[model samples]
Target: MNTTQLERIHSGKGFIAALDQSGGSTPKALQQYGIQEDRYSNADQMFEMVHEMRTRIIKSPAFDSEYILGAILFENTMDRTIDGQFTADYLWDKKGIVPFLKVDQGLAELDNGVQLMKPIPGLDELLKRAVERHIFGTKMRSVIKEANPAGIRQVVEQQFELGKQIAAMGLVPIIEPEVDIYSADKAASEKLLKDELIRQLASLDQDVKIMLKLSIPTETNFYSDLMQDPHVIRVVALSGGYSQAEANEKLAQHQGLIASFSRALSQGLTFQQSEDEFNTMLAKSIHDIYEASIQ
Candidate 1:
């Protein structure tokens, strides 16, 4: 493990930036950024366009480590360069931010009222490559749609199972098991998910601490116990499908949880904004999220 990065993450006073939109979600992300599908003809062009958006965000004046502890990258972005340095290196060396990689292949079809992650082939190889690039950790996601114990157990189990492998490689894993915010049984699902997580976390060895990324619970401080667990390094909240305003409002009620937002983080950004306008908007967003995180 990178002890410096580990300590920074354990004690950092900022939210994480989730910039890992993959192929399936790239169009929506680009569209929100004021780019349309017609602007790109193929996959390569599509990726190029999205990469440009990510690069612009990373290079912005407001994206420093002061209110942004880390940023998670897609595999392509991880392999790309920023201002003549690898993306991870640029984040750590130039901006004083830690870097993480999104490792899941994406969720599988909904099953048993949940959507577990698809198998991640070559994960070990990917972890090795991430280590070479100075990556501090990784993130994977699964989803819970209803209050089904069987399904939630499977999701949590899969996350921890893979988390151990990631830890064995000396990389901390942000195990994300997201509960759909719009589900009728959202609160119930959150409870079941939390129970399962505690059960699984208790079985781990003392040295194998991990991070968690979860949807902001319907009840304020619902995850407070998990935050106090010694096995958990930190508990971060995903914006899920909430708008930035709504997400930040919910996040503020939880003192220890911080944000790791995607759409929410890039909410008002557009491809055509002037640099000054872009920076101003970004600075506001970062400040709002940071305030809510530390509240």
Candidate 2:
């Protein structure tokens, strides 16, 4: 990759906004506005509503790309047309925001109490589709709700293995291994995850580079060394059920780590708000997250 391209993928200047709620998470998001799943009747109907939400964001006065480096999209969002332009094209051409796709199928239970994404059966084909649509990268998630050495090791291996495949296809991968904030052993979980992550990355070829989307650490600056690693292109954080205020506080403590939050990024934003009110809240959230990101 060119030096400029590397910077575009790795720079610590901006944050990513995650809008890629799969089918499993979308209905709950709609329910927050009192729209029930039964009203949709079909998956396409549901997707249309999500597309409208995306349209609102793109058309908002505060939807500048300055604070937002990129937006992650569900597969449908990747293909859907917005104002006669494909969603990915619209984001890049109009907002200058890079587009990424969520490639993982939702999580599946592991015997050890962790969750891993279901197998993505046609990932290479999906990568070809992403390339055709001009998507810049992909994001997949695995969750560690408790501390288990065996489970953490599995998550690290799968994420890096998949990440290498993504990079080989000429797109960056954001390997998100999120630790649930509610866990009693959050600190120990982070340590185990980080140790496994370092081991996995060290095993890969030296030229390989990938991004990490982690939960905010219980220990301040716990991820500093990972952020500085040669193999880590960038380190981004998930809200992982944290409130916007708490997420910002934790994120601000770690340098070179930025936010790629979903719920926190959209907290207080809803269809019920007036356009002006919606814009104001969204802008403030972006500003606050941005400040934490670059601090």
Candidate 3:
């Protein structure tokens, strides 16, 4: 990332809008909202619908970029043109919304029942393309299902390795080690995650600043110190299938960890509403999340 782009992301407004759901996630999200899968048989068709949904929000009169520092983009939508302007250019030029690309392919099952994002071949080439497109950063994800120390360690190690590579490419990486919200050992898992993060950070170069997207904790202020680490540019929380209200409540407790939510951020929005109603609903949602974020 260029210095101006880095400053744009690390600025005091720390919220990130996670609209980067991949082909695997997009179809399901559309179905949940009553958009029939029969109507969109392929990924490109689904992306068109998804882009329409995102376009509505970004083009809304009440849309406020101040509530979000950046937006994470799906592979197809990253540079696709909408209204004769590239999506990234539209967001930045029109609303000052920084663009971040989601570089990970979908996840694959890993050892010990864990899941890791499929390793991208030629990721260096991809990051170069993102830079050429003027994208500011990248996000990659992995999932932790149990409190198994070994499994967590593997995830931490791999994520940091990849994060360091991203930093070397001059792009900030958002390392997302998402804990299962349904886990019986949520608190225990968080402790393991914290320990693993600290262990990994010790080995990372001090100048390689990165961001994190963690599952919101049930306990209040569990990651305060971790968020304050100098290597951690920003710490943001994922809703991890929680409802908007529940996510907001949990997010409020973590002082510096702001929202990078997907489902929670779009919870009340729908295709049935009029454009005016849609904008009003989204504006309210953004305001509520922003309030929780800055708390």
Candidate 4:
């Protein structure tokens, strides 16, 4: 939800997954690509996998410090529920790296658990504090199946309240209207979607900066004009985890960093033994992309 931190990642669009699995000294990243494949294995024997991953990197004999160039918090999965602010704290403490969080994919269950853990703890304070910055959320469907204006009103009202909660806290809530593969009525579809976005933003009544954040739009033209505006920066989120092909496509076109939730571990790596192995592999792919561009 921290917007400025997200902006910082454009320097290197990196891959991210659960931190619990990705800490190790082994260059599994290089090895996974057959550069050093013999050196890799799953860390199935470890008790504290995430901690182990962290230990490996922080104590690496190669790197002088834990100053990784790029880091992604796999906002998918329950890692955050056990520690919502943990990743945030890690990023805050770890300078020289752009730390980004990918939410909306696997946040539902984790969010629910947090609510139950501290329900009604500080609604007003959270809302007010959130207004000063961009608090991004993944895709949220704020539509009514019923065609009645009345039904739309009810749904819109909910979005407005939530938007207000975000805006009041000094944060801009990024209400993304998704147009994934199966969506029909491209133009009309997006219009409807953006309309809902605005309805909620309007209800916030100028308390926060309202930018229309979205995944890859149906066509770039859908947001071609808006992309130039300083207040509007797009997220080039490519799902299906990560692939060299998809990474290349994003690297060629996007002025912003590419996002991945599931794709990091889902593709490319031949051998996988543990979560740390998986995470290191994902980070390596992203880092390689960064390196390729730098040279």
Give the number of the best model, judged by lDDT: 1
TM-score of each: 0.99, 0.95, 0.95, 0.49
| TM-score for candidate 4, residues paired by index | 0.49
Candidate 4, residues 1-295: lDDT per residue as tens digits?
4545545432333433222223232244434333353343454333233333443342233222132333344322123322334433444453344333222221122221111111224545533322221223322233222223343344445444554555454444444333333334444445554555555544444334433434344444455444444434343343322355554454445444334332343245443445467556545655554432233
lDDT per residue for candidate 3 within 152-189, as digits (tens), equals 88888888999999999888999999999998887888
The model with the greater TM-score, 1 or 2, is 1
Superposition-based RMSD of candidate 1 using all C-alpha atoms, in angstroms = 0.8
User: What is the alpha-carbon lDDT for the whole of candidate 3?
Assistant: 0.83
Q: Which of 1 and 3 is ahead in TM-score?
A: 1
The CA-based lDDT of model 2 is what? 0.85
lDDT of 1 by residue, 1-295 (tens): 8888888888989989999999799999999999999999999999989999999999999998999999999999999999899999999999999999999998899999999999999999999999999999999999999999999999999999999999999899999999999899999999999999999999998999799999999888999999889988899999988999999999999889999999999999999999999999999999999999998
Error of 2 at 125 (Å): 0.7
lDDT, candidate 1, at 90: 95
**Stretches of candidate 3 exceeding 4 Å from the true structure:** none
lDDT of model 2 at residue 13?
72
Backbone clash pairs for candidate 1 read: none
Q: Write down the lDDT of every candidate, Cα atoms only.
A: 0.94, 0.85, 0.83, 0.38
Candidate with better lDDT, 2 vs 3: 2
Better of 1 and 4 by TM-score: 1
Task: For candidate 4, give the lDDT.
Answer: 0.38
